[model samples]
Target: MLAAMPPSPSKPRNGGESHIRDRVRDRADACPGALRLHRADDGGLARLRLPTGVLTAHQVAVLAGAAERLGDGRLGVTSRGNLDLRGLPDDCGLALAELLGEAGLLPSAAHERVRNMVVSPLCGLDGRSHGDAQAWARELDALLCARTWTTALSGRFLFAVDDGRGDVAGLGGDVTLLAEPGGCALVRIGGLSWRVAAGDAPSAALAAAEAFLAVAREAGTGAWRVAELPDDRPLEAAVTECLAGAGVATSAASPGAVPVAAPPEPGVVGDRAVSVVAPLGRITAEQFRALAPGPGGEVRVTPWRGFVVAGLPGRAAAKERLAALDRAGFLTRPGSPWLTVSACTGRPGCGKALADVRADARPLDDAAVRGLPVHWSGCDRRCGHPQGDWVDVLATGDGTYGITVRTARRDNDDAQAQR
Candidate 1:
């Protein structure tokens, strides 16, 4: 029988609680990037940001090539639409930077880590969006790089640009720009929002970052994200003041519920596009190349660990591509078992991991296996679990497991012992 619950060390996160910080960290953020490779149990790991997850076919090929030559033969997709390369040698940093820079992936080395931004993947292509958030996302990325102070923003600080659909509005961004009617947008800083011209969204987002920096300086707590600030600090007032000082005009957003559509599933979007979900958030070099068939072709990597391939000749052609991808192991059909499972780089890749979570995930015969989104974590970090309600299958180091599920109807953690 399976059970749910782990010891405190491998506990699933209580959404109501903070990320284990009772006080400010009092140190620099150590989020790893292409330039700053993180030392993992499995060698140097690099996370390259794809702002809005847009990568040309050539860019994808370059990354896949790098994965085979410089490090592991696989590419890991992130919930935030970025890519990770693990198992690199210690001296591969310089070489990796050169390859990435040549591919136009690293625009500003100084601001690389702070470029954690995600845009509504379907914004420009679906035509249902109120604005071109894809364009806005790129513009914002450029603006963030042009400013030197933006580099001070924490690597964990996230900025989201949603095209009035609310798809990514609730992803816990430090700063969010939501599309509004009449070609305007709402800039949300903390709980408050200021109205800005659609064109001014980029600068306003930067202003929001500056505002966070200002408050962080005063708090002196080294708060990495807006939500992590001391409970006593007032976030709204400070961000408003920063915007005013930056000469960006503002108005409070109306207090009400924002309607967010469910994230796009695998299917033809509109008439000319289809989304392909990567199984278990892992896609290989060949798969990456397939997504970007020819040079100059573009693919939008989504926060949901999928790719939106647009600009097809027709619905038939899009469905044909989806079928081809499905044959090649990419999940192009809804309700695939792979959609509900995610695992971090466990075992040989992550020293902190207690077990090979991915290997363990394959053979679970329980009914709950496909009932809810389940993340198999080697340790407590649960690095890339789904955001909303789901089940967590955590491996306890001492030859057992813990299963925890948190949903609107129930929340419980139970311990499991091996037979």
Candidate 2:
């Protein structure tokens, strides 16, 4: 749904614009969606944004089939609880879109890419939840897809509906609704939260999106994301004003506890579900197809770059699959080496990369990385760092790397240690 704005001539030649232009020029580095495919160095990359991380079994199978037939057969579960199919052939964009649309995966062609929504993976399954956020997520998604103006929103505009545990809200969403008791919810936009009646969640969220777009347009900043907007256009105040205009009551609530639970470290959550981690968020085509559960069973892809097969037949079978995955070098055990480290594709896939950061980083055992979560990058664009806090290892064009640890260190320690 996201459209690229023409570059502004009056804008200064900042490095940010240059980088974006370079990406756009090379392979049309647009964010991949079901309809608009991104041509990576490897091939075409298609990202299927799964709003609410909920998919029917049939939909999943269709995705698997598309990946096998049109793509390279490997599927990537992204940190946004979305799926990516790489190595796609040319001219497959329309066909793939049609296939996904037939499966109800592409509800709206214009809104397909902008429908970035995430909810608690355990919203309904977890007993401690305030209430099911799934319904609200669906309602909001429907509203988003139906809006023609929403096509102007950037592909990165995120909406998260958390079921009161503060899970999805912690990831810093453009618009977030945290479920509360007494049939009410807390709505937040750009770090500010407001309590609203539960019945107003969807409308309030839509209002927030509209307010954001208004601010972006007024700012004339050519900013595509909420975070990039100038300081004068405070998103919170705009959202509040928009909601009031819609006759929705609101009250401020400070951002609450967002748990730092790492992806379920390769264990049994309960008698029914088994968690599996795809190392570096990559899974082969055969692995994806083989992992699809039977009828009445489902897979829940977590925002932490992992997935769970819920309602398994037995613990033994699940354990066997987990062990097999582990043997294939996937992380399925608590404290596994792959759990602590994450890296973006470097030399081969990205032209901006200075080195093969992923390959160079593969040898560093996670057990040796102490203190904080560590993310390796090929360039300054640290695509995905731990949402809360983490150590950053940035690569220089000269093949050296700089490390920035978020934790306090001893007197002799250096924050920007070079390696």
Candidate 3:
């Protein structure tokens, strides 16, 4: 008999009650951008959107300096391959925007937040994958920025340019372009695919996004995402027609490719590359400063809440740094508890929150909790929940928590008794 897999932990239960009205139900809330910060209960939160997860050494230094000077000396890596700085002082938004713009980080003022794009971190690093997606990312970004109509697109809209490995496409992006042999590619929007040549990938993606926006506007139901549009809209066909109009030959593909599983692992690859994972997607300002390699070395913030430091000094030096980071609990090791846990700010940070979920979660030994990933939420909105299957631990107004497991559909209660 084969060895049995580990038994998954019991799913957390939810109180099944919520007091805050759903802002995203009718339309997506304006997610914070570097230009526009969101005032959280704790402080101002600024999200720096990275379209292709690419960043230069100098850019990384700028971010580190900004975090130290303008906000709390900490950086939060978002699930969308973006960077976030919390606890920013009032009136710092404009300065942050100007600094980012000067560094070529802010390409467009109107389309900043709407530039929701994610790419595989190992795209160019791994030889087995297709050619670098960086050039294509730039092309698509230019198309998005130049198009005035794209300003109307919601911040929730997502675009993924994958290099045939299906890494980012699996994130359920609104638009995905998957590479194939013979210079052909597959473009997918809302789970629908269209076959197109490699050269047309950028235009095809832009057209698909435009099609989604048009459908959403026509629906007039305040739908923010393509999936929210009624089924009758037929978004896929509309996108295909739009691509054709753009002089892009297209056809449908059967049963699109599946997403791949490659967690961000920190180590020295070859003589220069080093991958580092930010624990629970958060890193201190001091940590970032230490890792900011100057010139020749670049940082690629990944959608997986980690960053790859490339072009290091030497293999031995890179390995030593990686080992140090590992010891400091920055690397995503096999049994690291941080990998299985995520939490949203609660308590003083948000007036809508019922409890200090992060504070409560800080004491839990996640190593003791196995199986499904666990996300702690102060309210039912479950903001920042992992895209994949996870166990939900929701706080109730009565100072207790309800847990809901996605796989088992089981519920349980844990009282927050005093120690």
Candidate 4:
């Protein structure tokens, strides 16, 4: 799939109805994909998109070997449930691509980057969901790759298939499908939503995206996300027409708040699923080896910094497996310090960074941060910050740091403190 992308110009974009600083991206994003590596200060950076975040033990081994042989022997996890391999030698891109293709990780060259989908990772196994979101996710991924128009979607465009769980729906997907009771789903585009048959969720989601493209084209802006549309654009009307053109029926969603579920803690769920938290959202080859199940077992990585291994023999067995993972340095219990802290690739990895934030960051005890995340950044870009509430620890010149605490505050206020 990586090899399929033609060497296109990193073209700059122009013309738009209106633009906001955040939504106004004047250039196409050069976000690295598994095949499209980015030249970072830490050498080549390759991001592998894992739809549904499912990977087998064999795949894990392949990645581990690649990390050891090509990268810096560490696997970084993205908030979107994707995997990243950094510090790769420039000449090893072809080798990495070959390995990924052979492992079936690169299914469609054209659709690899657009496969930015996050679903309810613990769905089917937990029995806490209204429907099987994992099934929907797979079906949706297949549907996405089958259509050629989906290739036009920006790499940042994301899809969320939530099993009536609010956890991932709030993760900011351009097109979101929240499963509802009675075999129905709420398809949301921007703020507008429509209720449709669960079976048609994939088509509805695509239709909504098609509508976004139409509105964006009319706006004449190189807008990448639905939230970037001009103020004059009517999302609801456009989406409705697009769905109608697709021969899909829809009904206005009921007026209410979307339900949400907090992330699952590292433990056994019911009698089948077991979760192990990856400390600092980073894991090593040996750590991954310790977490892999025997042949035929499955692992589903979650949006949060860990993955859930379902298909356990029983609840008792899951406890044992989770305990083993804990021993291997995974955060297996709640209230662990690793749960409330994260940092970006500091100093040696990012050329723009002034400090090695990862090295300087420490796990924050719960009471210290009071359950709010504390992200350490090497510079003001504050890359890889968490989606929700958090404290920003940004490095300023001359060994000083700037701190900004943001949480539901659209307008931010900043404070400065010295190291």
For lDDT, the strongest prediction is 4
By lDDT, is 3 or 4 better? 4
1-419 per-residue lDDT for model 2 (tens digits): 11211111222123233222211111212677877887778788888988877666777788888988998887887779899888888889888988998998888888889999887777665475775687888899898888898888888888888888777777768788888887888776654567778888888888988988897766565556655554422565577677878777776465554443334557665656667777877777667665576567777787878777776677776777677666765677787666767777677777778888878774254444563667788987676656655677889877788876653332112311210
Worst 10 residues of 4 by lDDT: 1-10
lDDT of 3 by residue, 189-211 (tens): 76467777788889988998888
lDDT of model 3 at position 145: 93
Return the top candidate by TM-score: 4
Clashes of 1: 5
Computed on alpha carbons, the lDDT of every model, listed in order, comes to 0.77, 0.71, 0.73, 0.78
Model 2, runs deviating above 4 Å:
1-29, 232-237, 245-247, 255-262, 313-329, 363-371, 397-400, 406-419
Poorly placed runs, candidate 3 (over 4 Å): 1-28, 327-329, 362-369, 407-419
**Model 2, poorest ten-residue lDDT window?**
1-10
What is candidate 3's local distance difference test score?
0.73
Candidate 1 per-residue lDDT over residues 1-419, each given as its tens digit: 11111101212123434233444567888888999999998788899999878887778889989998998787888988899888899999899999999999999999899999888999876767887788888998998898898888888899999999899886767888898889888887655567777887887788878878887777676778875554323455665666666666665456454455667888788877788888778877788777874333468898888898877778788888888888878878776667677787778778889998877775245786555777889998888876657787899998677998756223222211100
How close is every model to the real structure, measured as TM-score?
0.87, 0.82, 0.85, 0.89
Candidate 4 lDDT by residue in tens digits, 27-127:
77777999889999989999999988898888888888998899999898888889999989989978998899888898898888999988988787766
In model 4, the runs with Cα more than 4 Å from the true position are 1-23, 363-369, 409-419
Report clash pairs, candidate 3. Answer: 11-405, 12-403, 12-404, 13-402, 13-403, 13-404, 41-349, 42-349
